[model samples]
Target: MTRMECRRSLSAPTGTENDTRISTHENESECNEIPQSKSYPVFKNIGTSQCLNASQEVSDTGQCCHPSLMGLANGHCSNVLEFFKDIPQDVRKCLVEFLSSGVTDDLEIHEGNFHHFFHVANHLNLRRLLQCCVEVYEKGDKTRIKEKIGMCECVHYLEQLVATAYRRETSVLWHEKDLDSDRKFQVLFLTKDKHARKQPVVVIDFARNFKIYKQDIEKADKVGVGFCACAFEQDGCPYIFVSGGEEKKKSQIWQYDVILDKWSKAGKMLHGRSRHLMVAVKDKIYLIGGQNVACIEEFDPISGKCVEIGSLPVAAWSSTYAVNNDTIYIFGGKNPAGCISTVQSFNCKTNRIARLGDLPCACSGSRAVVLGDFIFIATSEGHLIKFNPMDGSSELCALQPFIRRHFVMFVRNERIYITGGVRKSNDKGADENHLYKYTPETDTWSDVATLSTSLPVYTYCTVRYSGKCIIVPFEKFR
Candidate 1:
């Protein structure tokens, strides 16, 4: 209902900043300093009188020959108590206060401490501590901790550390014949320290056999036909936005959460559109030409509202378009005069549109995909036209084996994939569904796989998410 100007800020630090914010004491010794042999700390089990050596080499399995300071009689041996003394005095004091108070408000750690803390935990086999950090990082709620730290930094460090530790432990276990295959060893130490703080340890199961199988995926919740969809990720979750289709060219919007495998209503657009082009740049989704409309609208997913940004110089429908950098290139489409080969460019930063050169020929209902600086347009006549928007030069590169119209195309892993397009039948003389793959390096086209049903030929949208191709079919209108 109201127009809002979209702006982005660049206030965050460019490189790694302090995430933990743990106070540094002027009197405390350096964290990197190795303790002298004479000054090495002595660790003792809570109930045992004998002290354990700090430099005692822990087995690859973390089993200690002598009793551990945590009072484990014959379990995994760890020198965490000894290593705990090596941490900066300020850090040690904060940790002690944190443990004693049971309140995070007084204890503040920076994100920069994540790497150091993780390495220390791995060296000491502090499984509970690692799990606590993992939970805090995953939840992304700084308030859950007394002092806020960088959740992303902590989570990234923990993932890398865990993966590396898991690999190393597996390698050692595979080579050791004396270690029983049935023995359940904790790669991530879940044992509690003297403080009694314990958390669940994620065990690496080596006995289970993993297999990969190709199976048909269940259909997503039905949405209206003729709508356009775009894929993007936010807050570590993948989502697909479907908008402006059937239901009388409704402005209704819906979002599919890949993680939850559920669909929910997003806000409606300012104008109902079909056969439109939607491209996500940063946080905003740009809705381009559709249904004979020259007006362009910008939809903000965060605000759940669309605003009229600008208008196209020429009204067109079913035109092939692609975004390169901050500019959007619109190619051939049908206009009032019929099929038009006009090409135009819209600068997003300046909100201005300028005329580029026309295509080699009119290509209504064509699909355009951008790979690097080159824009490839697949036309209904089964022609693959490569055009450079910078110099306005166009050339016909390769021809498709089967002519197609109203098809979906996208680029993934540097290869172009096309599917669900109508093709002339060889025997029955009726239009059939077909799938194709094109590689830019060899400038060639090849047939990859086919679909079970021909419904995609009628109405469907394709998006690549999490290294997998997801095809969402539109519900047919009765």
Candidate 2:
């Protein structure tokens, strides 16, 4: 019963200043008849001079006492916690008082009490305890703090560390509201102008939501070309089929149905479409650019046909596209003549395609995805371009890492997952079933889980269902 009570009493921190006297007497005693009830060894080690001073905190009956130290020279130390639950309250108080401000930072007074000490130090926001924590961590192995809460570099002194850390964590979560919904919105501060910047961003696609709708998401009514079977899916897939087929007839704009779990029909346009840029805004899908022609068309997958929205101010198909609110940005696409860095955009509501800006370098077939507010343009030839929509201006990301691939992909989950695609470079030529995952934290790409087959590079669309990213085989949309 006494042992159980002692354990319960020590569970809470106490500041006992007594218990030091009689400790030496017990240590030097040759008497084997001492009663077990009062023979605990915690107080039996103090020498005569210290034992006398220790008695000042003892009660009149010679029993241990707990009292705040007043005018003892140093300030009152934080309550040091005991790791063992069964310790007597008197002992816990004595230990805390002894190790208060006077204790050495590098030494552990009690063995096996590290966790209790650290927890209490963190909770009380004590500087001395924090210093002790840092010392213990430095003296011990890295595994000690490997999986700890608020994990990070340790401070040398505990003084206000615990209190400061709590406030920091609380504020960090305030800026992370949309993070839980798997949707993020960020504004880029590139020195460019003349673009709409309103749209919910779906980033880190592989780890979260599946599909794309931003920038130029327009709803088309009964729009298709030639023969139409009809394939329109919900939130439809965000993936775009921007690849230009060898023949003009091969390049096509298609949409995948995320809900129906199949790719459906989108209206074919009057002109033969190849190497076109497709972006969804509001309720309409804008198919921009084609080989030997700089024409743009809007397709209504529900209607199963296309309408000539307007022609781009430039002559190029297969141009790289980025969308910001109502604008479908076209940049760095090769014309029948050669590679051009011309920038253009199609406003869905305005019904027009206008030149916006130019690229830092003339390149095409690169991947452009939004991270935060700035659009990160990774060229097929391995150059990173940053374009600001507000004004038509772009710059090269010389310090950023670049991975080149031909397949069109999306930005989601803070990562840029690139599936299999052809690459042509002497130092980095890749043409296999390549699946790569990149972490923006380290700005590096590493190989992870791979797909059974290379992503279908249709001149059309693809959808991810359950855990499968299925691409509708696009022999013909109509």
Candidate 3:
């Protein structure tokens, strides 16, 4: 299914009282009192026998709280609130009791109080209370609530809110599942700019309609030059381990604390490697290949140490890898001669390496990701290869837009995204600001968003976490 986008139909929170007053008429039932088994603590404390009047603003604050409540206009409640004086005393009492402390079980929902409570709650943006009102209305005479809601001044907004509440109440589980699946993972993009004072981090939140934000390292943390980073979670906290550098920074690994926004030296590789592939499997991280090193070493985040488990059967440089269970599939890479089509699999459990099959063509400077039973590889040649390990079958589809090599690719929520790495007209490697999203289901590509800065090739990785909004909004959202 296509991902759901979050859009605001109504104005954003204004931090003030709702100014839309409908001048509703007081129902005749307002004069009648209904005895309740429960007592109103807030009402008693405020020295009031009934809920606050609709036109009554809390003191001189010019704002209202729960309809059944009064005297809460102080800076206590920040959410938008409204009151309808025309609602009956008992219905206002129920609204106040429900909205005040979020108690709905004891609120007597009879025919006399249904229409008033539903309309008031819907108007006040009390979604929970409106949902309760919808449940009660659905159990009784639905036609009456329909007519009552249809008669509201802003019939469109009123009926829309009513239908939303009704749908939410009926398919709550389905809605919850859809939300969880769509927004569960957050994608983070980091740039490799050693000259910058602090590292630039881009956080993408799919929950908020693919919202993008920027952050700094906050502390004196900077990624080393010529670094290859891998995003992994340690102890339930997201982290990015960056390795590879030149001179003094070589072989050193840095652990970035995503939560604290701090960076510290984590560990060092046994061999300083460049053009290598780093992947996280379970709790351990595997650093494979290098310009010359053929050994594959495993690094333990907890111990902060690297140990060489085995060596590649055929050492290949500039190779990419994808892990499935205990096995890691090493894709095409360059050697001393040139790019090689050799494919190899290393089993972490067995500590063994075996040749799988050759690629349709050598794919140096490529990226690979596993989706279901197939592995999708995006080559620098602008070709997408789908490889099936079961039968050793491979199919290549050339990306028309990506006529030149140098783009970066990453997968989130089973969708592939390519950005940056465009060869400029100057015949020089430059950053391409355009971001493209590819969907395997339809085998189609669409430009999604342009980045504030070009994404560096092999210098970015996605970390999943609960993120916050940024001060600088992405151009796409604006």
Candidate 4:
């Protein structure tokens, strides 16, 4: 029911002055009361009257307006029309019908035709139609829309439309200028170049069709033997902290800024460690058992310092763990007596350790990931154990198809993905390059895809970045 008024000065041969006005309505029924029924009127100051023709071209810019006018000022033209040369005829008809009736009954917008509608409506200056297109874009699925629109295409146009329509910025599409939080969740696999000895962190945007290419991502700086890595967020920025590997005396912690894509020395762990586990709870990192060190240390990213919080009651190392409710669940690991089926819980709040129960078997080199209320442990013996932490009850969930040790386990979209492990055998296991997917709903496992390279056991770590699985491999991929 709202009407739009436009005023522009016009020069005529007789020096006559006049003003033109435009009226538009949300309801098409209002147009019936005008002198010309079902037709839009375009009145000019130069005593010219014309009916708005959607298909007619009235300007060199290929815009439609009063035929008598040489040009129209920005927003001064009553009717903004374009031929929609590239658009399909049905789509063109839909747009023209919307302009005439202001009804969207036949305006079917979807992923396939969104770009066409957006370009046509934007070019014609149809703000209402453009707003509709933006709404469709906003309500789309994040991963799907990202794949369709790409990361950079038409983002500014959408931004401008949102600003004009809503008077505020909208997070409709991700832009390079957006904050790190706006970026998509990514998975990173750190691999070393054999020739140059440089570590190139492989970034995986799993949501973008789960595509991986080594040449597409830039190379990270040369790093030492990285034992384990964990991602932590500090003051709204994301970072990956890598602990040194193998050298017993190597305690340097390298911090990788996810936003800046740069690496530098964050600090050193309290003790030189290898075959350790690093987990982030809240803002602090807990580094547990490495090599001969049985003490657990807490690292503060802000202070760049590590403090010995406590130590494991028994000698335990090479075990996989997961954190829930501020408690670290340590599964079976090796001791002076060899592999033990010990399931222990360490409370972060009280800094206390207690024995929960024994794992199904003495799993020395296994991987564990938490899906829901249960912790799924993939043992090197080809057994998948499901452990319920609430009552410390454990049972075998399923059998792994591949009997592999030193593998990486991660969860995405309520499903588990394991990649880059060494095949368990008597003669020093061989590296595995296949990625396997486990669906808990059906208790099934399937080999989905093969990785570009194999990720060895202690050489890689997994963390969730923005809720997406990120695998940080610290070894050279053969």
Candidate 5:
């Protein structure tokens, strides 16, 4: 999809209140008397007889004259017509009681009020109302409310309610799995200065909020730009491996101890390859597709040895790959002829590569991640394609116009976040400074947050450790 089309689809509807307003004549016939129920404690305090008489008078005369309910009869109560239009009679009555009260101390009251409020808001397509609820919960004082609920508890409940409403409304588009178990993880970024040729590893801890710390690694001759890095476990310890970027340098590999904050040499690859992709499957780390290399190399961390296992059908470079079960799926890269759209799956058990299918378009320097049963690839053209390996089918689903060459894509919890790529425009815009989030369940793209520093296209390596995203820059800071 083009950028304009994507924006139109995501744009909010306008003039909803004017188009769906309920007439005062209809209100007179329908809501003549406020229902008498235990759920409506606010009405009891106002004196039911007096409240009903006032409601009837206002509904009939179209004038909110009652002093007691003047506030409700004017602003808040105006929403009742649209709110109750779709909601069931029982739910509407209960909601009216709770919302009319405006505040409550009972846990059940809080739950019931928010539950139906969300439903009503969704039914009316009141996105602003939902957003207001979130904003109020985040920024408003919880202590001032009658419920005495903690801010954290209120936010949690609000998220749950929204998720439930999203599922009910968009079941087909919604992802079945919940991300409640996903925790915040720290990110490690390796940045370089082009002029001085200085590379420093920066660690960002998001677990206890976001904090950044930088550490300098003992630089290697070959470890500069276009190098491949991935997080792997040796024995039970976690470590990061960096390998093969500079052609003049030998096939040297370096390992960094994440816990000790130290760097050391590891086993070298058989071939000096740059712009390759690395993923750890089970006990072995597999490096595939880079520059002129067609051969797939596997490194055993335990033995500190590297061996060539398989070769691609053609020489591929700058492609992205993700692992599922025992197979690694690689997609989109440039060959000698130019960019290719081939998808290849390498099965570890068989020790062979098989052609799965092709991408919708040829893409190089793209990124891929496995979520559930599908492998999602973010293309250089800013289109997101999901490939189902089971049936060998590929479909273009989402569009992100800012994704150009050299961007990094990673998944946290269940959402995919893309950072640091150039924009597809004549200006050669600085998209590297922004971070975008792709929600698979909704097939929408949104700008979430900005990065501390802009990343050069295809000059950085990213890995997720302990639920955090770590970035290592290979290009000079612009």
Candidate 6:
């Protein structure tokens, strides 16, 4: 799967209102009833309706605007708020009821009603209206609304609002596995930048697309989470491999169908092989070396078929492989007999394999990520090696704070965050608690923020999400 790019389709919200008004036909539907126009600003027949605009003062210029947008038009203040400007007494009560007295709603700096309202409020320096922007956006999921927001003085509005715990650079926070014990799921992820005015952090329900459902996190009777292979199918969403574990295990390859909210079992591998590593390249998932000297196999997700792809130089299992450009490069992994520092590369274009330089240490489970033209390999002995595939030349950088083997290193906002792995002194145990960020520009590692969410990295701990690295913490699953 290539990648799902975030397309900024939001149009700047305009202050102008639709001049093309529909005359009062007085039609009623669940959507809205007694739709009001300037001809009659107030309607007693309409039970309760929230007024989106507060422009009490009508400009005879016959120019209708989102009242907030008018602030940018003439920068003049008058008794413009007409009689109908207040969110209608009944509607006002409901809107107030929706808000937390202490929690002021903030808007996505550039989009939506509140985002624009906040902009006008800020231009006039009205602190109270500016605060309401937050809650309004949170009450509405931003990603879903990003495409509809009109671009209006969004930058100026963002400058004044308070910042929160949310990542300014992220447009979306993907919920990987939303399945309850009932075996349900929702999948997909995306992000955005800070200064850009965006929507509030509101939860969404994939079960009903376009309709939000409140799903309480359910407690499972018994969790059977274990080592599994992951690959992209259908579109770019990820699917898990429930087979390819130990032999004697009933053959099954369960894939989580995110959009449909279901699971599918693909055909089994030739035989079960535990502690095996999986990597997807050129639309096909390669079940690389594994325990029991398992043969490399190519899985066609479309057909649910597994075809053998020869074998690795060593009978290795659980090694890290990084996909760079058109090639999938395998780093160190423990061969069936022992841990090896061997390096191998498979070219997608040529469909052939070749060997590269040996890692400084014979470590398995560490991650190899391709950034720019360099592949950075970190090991269980706290060793960080930068290798170039073009000439097979490698340079060692300052090591990690602690040693880990099966951690996930992925890119976000152009920064690489390394999460979770195991160590040798700990045997098959891993304490992937420490998260590190490496800035290739500075060739430096800095500890940014750590996930308070506990993710255990046990013997079979592996993190993978289509188009991103697998992030986890240390754990002992016994």
| Candidate 6 ranges with C-alpha deviation above 4 Å | 1-226, 236-238, 247-251, 421-434, 458-478
| Worst 10 contiguous positions by lDDT, candidate 1 | 1-10
The CA root-mean-square deviation of candidate 3, after full C-alpha superposition on the true structure, stands at: 17.2
Q: What lDDT, from 0 to 1, does candidate 2 have?
A: 0.42
What is the model-wide C-alpha lDDT for candidate 4? 0.57
* Local distance difference test scores for all models: 0.50, 0.42, 0.57, 0.57, 0.54, 0.44
Candidates sorted by lDDT, descending order?
4, 3, 5, 1, 6, 2
Candidate 1 error regions (>4 Å) = 1-223, 424-435, 448-478
What are the C-alpha RMSDs, in order, of all predicted structures?
A: 20.6, 25.7, 17.2, 20.6, 22.1, 18.4
Better of 1 and 2 by TM-score: 1
Give the least accurate 10-residue stretch of model 4, judged by summed lDDT: 4-13
Can you list the residue pairs that collide in candidate 1?
Answer: 19-110, 19-111, 20-109, 20-110, 20-111, 21-110, 104-146, 105-146
Choose the strongest candidate by TM-score. 3
Selected candidate, larger lDDT, 3 vs 6? 3
Query: Between the candidate structures 1 and 3, which one is better when assessed by TM-score?
Result: 3
For model 2, state the Cα shift of residue 269 in Å: 0.8
Per-prediction TM-score, please?
0.50, 0.43, 0.57, 0.57, 0.55, 0.50
User: Which stretches in model 5 have alpha-carbon errors above 4 Å?
Assistant: 1-195, 200-222, 424-432, 457-478
Tens digit per residue, CA lDDT, model 5, 325-426: 899888988877998999998997788888877888898777788888898998888889999989889999878856466566767547787776556666
lDDT of 6 by residue, 207-237 (tens): 1111111111111111122234454544433
Q: What lDDT tens digits, residue by residue, belong to model 3 across residues 237-290?
A: 567888875433558888875533346888889999877888888889999988
